[model samples]
Target: MLVSRCKFTGISAPFSVGAFVKHLAVPLSTRLHCALVNAEGGPQSRAVHCPKFQALKSHQKEQLHLYVDALLEWNQRMNLTAVREVGEVMERHVEDSLSIVPPIRDSYLSRCGASCGKISVVDVGSGAGLPGLVLAIAEPDWQVTLVESMRKRCVFLEHAVNLAGVSNVEVVNGRVEDIGNDSCFREHFDVAVARAVAEMRVLAEYCLPLVRVGGLFVAAKGHNPEDEVKNAETAIRSMGASLLQVCPVESHGPYGQRTAIICLKGHPTPRKYPRSPGTPAKEPL
Candidate 1:
């Protein structure tokens, strides 16, 4: 039987008056800042203001700052993301990543055992570790594995892992298709998550195989996704997965909408899944 052993701590933080005035380029509000800070570490973790970041736990907010800074720096050399300013990182990158918590928690609980101990999760095609590293940093218990096909991105992922001082995370340099078939990877994880990687059908092929029976495959999508869900039904079923639910996610204050498609693995994935790296992308289902 599937169960939920995962614990999600939502970080919440608010900006002070001085912080608001400094980032005049973006209309920063104390309430929104507070919501995001809280969302990052949750209400109980810690809270921080500029110059001095105080919280129940020291270093989470600072760690968040460092990760954002690294992404911004690397973005200059490679086009990782368009969010240029620091404020944008808090809104677009940080909050956007954290918004998946509800769906992730709900899906896991409905399926496998509670999210405790070394609950495994693999992020397929984790370009710069969007939800993977972000989730790892927030919830320390998850044994997070980030799989990346590109060499440069893998290097950046390693740097991010070390910078974050996260011991529970690992970076695997390979295509999702190749990694999924490895005996060690097939049916190995409690959850498999992908964000902005591809359409649902294509992603199911790349992700579902890595999830054990009764585990979940969560696909993070932007905006309305009714049609994509419909198109992926056949592929999802073929991969021994069934769509369990679709959860809508939004930032606490004036944030955009995000969708997470939760599919539960009903049986062991076919051994031939995750064909060639480009095959799924080239021809979904």
Candidate 2:
């Protein structure tokens, strides 16, 4: 396995905002000044004015800022994400991640009724934590597990989680297929989500097994997924899930319109599903 050959970088000390700022590539004074300006909702602060960002509590906003700083810092050392600039990161990554929150909440509400409570969410193929860590930071009450096959990405996820001081998240350095079959994880979560991970058919195989019956499986995809959703109908049913909705998300930036393919897990997934590692992507369903 990749993890067997990979080395882990442990963060020995507890992470703090001050400690994190000092470690950034930019000068501390400049970084702090920029942070202050954003906090004050200056003309340079686009994220602060974003409706999704503005909806978060004061501390949640700060945690998100810390997460962005950590992501940018780590990206310099490793290929965490292609979006490099701060504004782009907020719009493309952070805002894009936050877009799925409503669908998840609505799904939870429609199924369980009343409040969302403490939901368990797993992000399959969570490269650099995208919606996984961002979800954890936004809704601290929910438990989020990030499943990433790549060891280096898992390392970056751990670092980001620590830096953001978010305790609701756990990083798993393993493949979804393997994790899906594990008794401890199979059908264990209330919700499973993936972003730009795979086609709908393949993603259904990878994510549906980890979701319990009556839970939700959300796939974040590009706008206009009608064809992909139509193509994946057979696979979706085979995996014991049914397409619930293809909700459109308001574009946060030039990344363009987005969609959340929400599926409802009405029954348990077949045991042989997800196939072996890389099989789902190669053979699909």
- C-alpha lDDT (0 to 100) for residue 252 of candidate 2: 67
Instruction: Score residue 275 of candidate 2 by CA lDDT.
Output: 63
Alpha-carbon local distance difference test for all models: 0.69, 0.77
Candidate 2: regions farther than 4 A off: 1-44, 276-285
Please name the candidate that would achieve the greatest TM-score relative to the true structure: 2
Q: What is the lDDT of residue 157 in candidate 1?
A: 71
Q: CA shift at 151, candidate 1, in angstroms?
A: 0.7
Lowest summed lDDT window (length 10), candidate 1: 1-10
Displacement of residue 99 (Cα, Å) in model 2 is 1.0
lDDT of 2 by residue, 1-285 (tens): 112222224322233444444554433123632662455443337656667877888888788877777777677776777877676677778888998999899878986554776999999988988789989988888999998877567766776787668899888777676788777789999999999778887888889999999899999888888988998899889889898888998766666889999999989889874563444342110
lDDT of 1: 0.69
